[model samples]
Target: MVMTQGWIKDNVQEGTPIKVARIYMKNATLAGDDLFIDNLFIGSDYDNYIRTSLPATPNGNFVYDVEVSKIDLGFDINFMAANCGHDFPLLGIKDATVLSGSAEPYSDIVVYGHPDFTAGTNMAVGRIVAATKPVTGSFELELNGKLVTVAADATAKKMKELVETNLDTGIVLVNQYGTCAGYAWDVEWASKGGNQPLIKVWCVV
Candidate 1:
């Protein structure tokens, strides 16, 4: 037998290379049984809250583009806005879309007599993905793999553009192999030769 003592831990620590989440564990969100609150005066992504007016008919969830015309009520949400931010694109990924109900407003409206179990009359957005496709690009020396992430729900083409933009920006991200080494991708115009520019390769069984 052994004696036990109290201990503590934290999810994040500095200088330890906090790995960005890749394989997310499943959560209650999988059931899509999201929480709901109604009758609020107003909301916006500025404060991590999004505002929306109840449409004539609740269109359900997973909708990326919606035109909210009832702006007279002071609801500043424009789902159809270029990337949808009520005009605040500056927020980028921190905007309303980050929230679960960003697309499915009035999901479970009790005031409307709608039960709280149905997330929306639709499906949740799926991660844009590719299978068995060659990742085209010359890598720096041996760097090959890339962990790309897109905050908003968009087409596969759009996703590629965003990922490329992220790489071109030269933002230092902690890759699986290195830190701040930047994109090892080689370019015919200008780029340093890498170790075959292939960071990683895998065989699907």
Candidate 2:
């Protein structure tokens, strides 16, 4: 028999409005009644006896403390960020169109999503799929094996200028849409694109 202890830190703060929508395991396997779980308790305290102090052994069961926090709200969290505090480096800029292309020369530009709410969900791994400048001054991205392109516009130009001017340092994130638009992508520079320099955005599918 194998016995183990587990603990999970929930993000529902002291005053965050929430509800236990449902309780169900995503996956499970049972054979000959091999696995049995009982005395499962989920609450702020142990047995309502200690309100502030968490008991090391709740109901005679050894407990394990697990560190977990929400990296960002309204986005599908991966295993790392959901269980640990590790967060992926996400590139965020305003009024920018993220695109996708291959590393080869003159690759076909793949455009996905519009500047505002047209592309779709933004809860995936983003990476630099391509760096070649497809247009005058736009960025490209590869998301989920599909090429997504953000055309060079005011936003792209601004981001490029910022990145260039800041000695290639990290840029601040600006969420104008009130939530993550699911444009998980990387950053790159295309010296010859559009009216000015271009910032390429690509997703790592």
**How well does model 2 score by local distance difference test?**
0.36
CA lDDT, every model vs. true structure: 0.29, 0.36
Across 100-135, the per-residue lDDT of candidate 2 in tens digits comes to: 532222333323344466356432224323222212
Name the lDDT value of residue 171 in candidate 1: 27
Residue 23 CA displacement from its true place in model 1, Å: 45
* Candidate 1 wrong stretches, greater than 4 Å: 1-78, 84-107, 110-195, 200-205
lDDT of 2 at 135: 22
Residue-level lDDT tens digits of model 1 in 1-205: 1212212125434345544444232233312122333333322222333448653222232223544344453233334321111211111221223334332221321111123325543223221211121122322111234544432223234434544454442322221211121112222312334433323323222
Question: Each prediction's Cα RMSD?
Answer: 18.5, 24.3
| Model 2 / residue 85 / CA error / Å | 40
Q: Using Cα atoms with residue i matched to residue i, what is each candidate's TM-score against the true structure? A: 0.16, 0.16
